[model samples]
Target: MVSKVKIKINDLYKIFGPKGESHVEKVKSGMGKPELLEKHSHVLGLQNINLDIIEGKIQVIMGLSGSGKSTLIRHINRLIEPTAGQIFIDDTDVLAMSDEELMNFRRFKASMVFQKFALLPHRTVLANTIYGLTMQGLEVKEAEERAAHWLKRVGLEGFEDRYPAQLSGGMQQRVGLARALATDADILLMDEAFSALDPLIRSDMQEILLELQEELHKTIVFITHDLDEALRIGDDIAILRDGRLVQQGSSQDIVLNPADDYVGDFIKDINRARVLTLGTLPLKKASTKGIALSNNTSLENAMKALVDAKKDSVIVVKGDKKLGSVSMHDIVHAATRSSETAGEAVTYR
Candidate 1:
């Protein structure tokens, strides 16, 4: 079944300077970012970006510094107005919202989690979590009940009374997450939300997010510069460079079929075994009596299963229906192939 598109961005353009609108024509007329800056003294932040964000799926926007990744995310909530573009959330025009409508949208329809753990230093954890609910004029008892539930959900049940400075960085970020989740918004805007944590903590946070997503299925827009994180969490990824989109696709698609040399370099050193899945491998009609594996199983896990079971091939199935059989040779070849040669000989469905 095809998922519904929750957010649609069309012809998005952002330019920075006093006369940003004036330079939009030049940018649309084929002026590059460097030339625009050097000649017009205006910075081009984004150029003609078009994307569809699926409902209840995580869409990650990633790139190096100055790639306009953060800028693009902010546009979803209209924190930064575009030079020219249209943003549709559930087919409703976001760019056309009045100030009051936008304020209500931010308060009820979506919530943001920042990288810096933007908690109130003066308020207790419970108070901070209930901040948004209170802003919406919810009753004190109801707000507290909602905040307490989300705090416990994020593993901060016992830390409700502690101030932001009293907790470690990871704990503080958890508070920020709980606060965002407490609002019960349909859309979650995470702007490099876990980029500030240590490696292990970041992994833990990712797991937490995935677990919650399995239950809540909120429409998530996650921003990051780390390719590993993007592949691990994003249902779809959009890569940007110099204020323009480089590529956009699933993790397997990008890993196996990079759009260009720029995207290829980003994924060249990545471990293909972890990113590619059995469902992406070519399906064969030949049947096998080996062990059965789910179609979504990773190549890394499939290899381990094969070695443990002492089998040369395994049957890939979706539920009880068998899709095809994949041999050990095919798995190894797919995982070990160089990224530059990817999607050349192998055809992934």
Candidate 2:
């Protein structure tokens, strides 16, 4: 079943300068970021970005510093207005909204989670969590109820009375997440929300986000520079380079078939066994006589299952229906194959 697109971005461009609009023609005429800046004194922030973010899916926009990843996400909420383009939420033109309408949209329709936690230093966790709700003129009792629910959901039930300064970085970030989720907004704009945490804490936060997503199914726009994080959390990923979108696809598409050497370099060192799933690999017809693995099982887990069961192959199933079978040889080949040699069809024997 095709998922509906919740947010649509078309021909998006952002150039920073007094005469940004005048230089749009030159930018469209094939001028690069550096050339535009060095020649015309305008900093190119985003170039002709087009994307359709599906509803109830995590859409990750990733790029290194100055790649315009942060810039792109800010555009979604109109925190930063575009030089030229259109942003549509549920087919409503965001740019066409009146100032009051835009204000209401930001207040009720979308919520942001910042990398720095963005919690009020003086306010208690409970108070910070209800900040947005209070701004919306929600009744104090009702806002507190909603805030408490989300704080508990984020595992911060007991810490609501604690100030942001009392909490650790991870805990503070959790408060940020709770605050965002408490609003019950449909769209979540997370701008490097976990980047500052230690590795283990970051992983924990990722698990929490995934768990919450399974239930809430919000249209989440997560911005990150880390490829591993992007692969782990994103349902769809868009990679940008020097203000231009370089590639956009699922983890399988990016890992198995990178758009270019730049993208291939980003994925070359990644653990393919952990990222690629059974459903992504080409399968062969075989008897469903041995152990069965789900279509979504990772290649690493599938390999372990085969080894533990002492089987050469396992039938891949989706629910009660058998899809196909995968062999140990196929798993190894798919995991180790480089993107340069990746297009050859898999033939399990």
Q: In model 2, what is the error at residue 79, expressed in angstroms?
A: 0.5
Error of 2 at 160 (Å): 1.5
> Each candidate: what lDDT?
0.92, 0.91
Q: Which residue pairs come into collision in candidate 2?
A: none
lDDT winner: 1
TM-score of 2: 0.93
Backbone clashes in model 1 = 0
lDDT of candidate model 1 versus the reference: 0.92
- Model 1 misplaced stretches (Cα beyond 4 Å): 283-289, 341-349
Q: Tens digits of per-residue lDDT for model 1 on 132-166? A: 89978899899999999999999998998999999
